[model samples]
Target: MIDVLVAGGGPAGLAAAVHARLAGLTAVVVEPRTAPVDKACGEGVMPGGVASLRALGVEPAGRELRGIRYVDGVRRAEAPFRDRPGLGVRRTTLHRALHERALGLGVRIVPGKVGEVRQTRDSVTAAGITARWLIAADGLHSPVRRRLGLELPGGPRGRYGLRRHYRLAPWTDFVEVHWSGQGEAYVTPVADGLVGVAVLSRVRRGYDEHLDGFPAL
Candidate 1:
């Protein structure tokens, strides 16, 4: 039986698998997607996130936006947090880096959607796949957690976020987060002559609803 079976391949799951293998656990990750999977994020790797990744020996695959800038946000002031440093990288890059790191450390990645998980006193079977223990690192809405009878709910209406890539050079080494009354938008530079920009709002609105208002977007 496997020591641990992870139910997702996202950042959290990837991180957990890397750490788990380093700890000498026979771990496996069940990812539903084949490859070139993506996430809808501004792709900014906060300094803290980078430090943690470095500790795990994860080499980043995307360009790093060397500095951090704070946009007033959809509701806050434009001043910097000053308390900490943030790294801006793409979500896909982060995923790829973590994916490799996990594999190098000997984590088995099962690339398929988990159907069900049955638990007994000594072992847990995920859709007939058995393991000594199971970790549900799926997305915010984790099916594994649901199957195990745990409740995962959304946080109080958070900003709605959207992102796009551009082929121009970056405006600054720092990631620029822009704020409007509706929400916040973030900009980051990634590899391949592209820049990643994200728009966030507390209320859910149609895509391109505020595109005209933001000239930079």
Candidate 2:
């Protein structure tokens, strides 16, 4: 039996596995997706988050972010970090780095999903593997949470995000937030020649429609 069984292979799960290994515990991560998984995200790591990743011995290559800028038409506000700069790393890059770190630390990553977990007084069993503890980092709508009846009641309508990348030189070193009545668009430079744009809104609409709202972007 392993000391820890992680129910996903995303950043959080991989980080947990690395932490387990650093604590001298055996960890096994079960994930159905392949490595370097990409998803819709702002891809902006705050300074504290960057430090945390570095403490875990994971350094991802990306453009450095000096601060944040909020834009509303002609009116805008900017704030620079007082200490260190943040990082605008791509999601895949971050995940890959964490995955590699965990593997290097002797964490076993299995290519499968944890299904129908069963837990006793001392151990937890899932996906034909048993562990002293199980971590459910399966995401927002985690099946593990659902199976364990740990889901909370739904509140107000939640916002959705859509991300895309553009091949262009970064004009600024700050993550830009373009606000509109419909939603907000986040523009961040993930690479020297690539920028990622993510739009978030509670309203259901197409990506182009959401982008139309942020004319200032």
TM of each candidate vs. truth = 0.83, 0.94
Query: What lDDT is obtained when candidate 2 is compared to the true structure?
Result: 0.93
Query: Of the candidates shown, which would achieve the greatest lDDT relative to the real structure?
Result: 2
Worst 10 residues of 1 by lDDT: 72-81
Q: lDDT for each of the candidates?
A: 0.74, 0.93
RMSD of 1: 3.2
Q: lDDT tens string, model 2, 1-217? A: 8899999999999999998898999999999999999988999999999998998999999999999999999999999988999999999999999999999999999999898988899999999999999999998788898899988888245688899999999999999999998889999999999999999998988999999898766
Q: Write the per-residue lDDT of candidate 1 for residues 141-176, one digit (tens) a residue.
A: 676776677874653444566778888887676777
What stretches of model 1 exceed 4 Å from their correct place? 72-85, 152-160, 202-207
Query: How much is the lDDT of residue 94 in candidate 2?
Result: 98
lDDT for residue 71 in candidate 1, whole number 0-100: 52
| RMSD, every candidate, angstroms | 3.2, 1.5
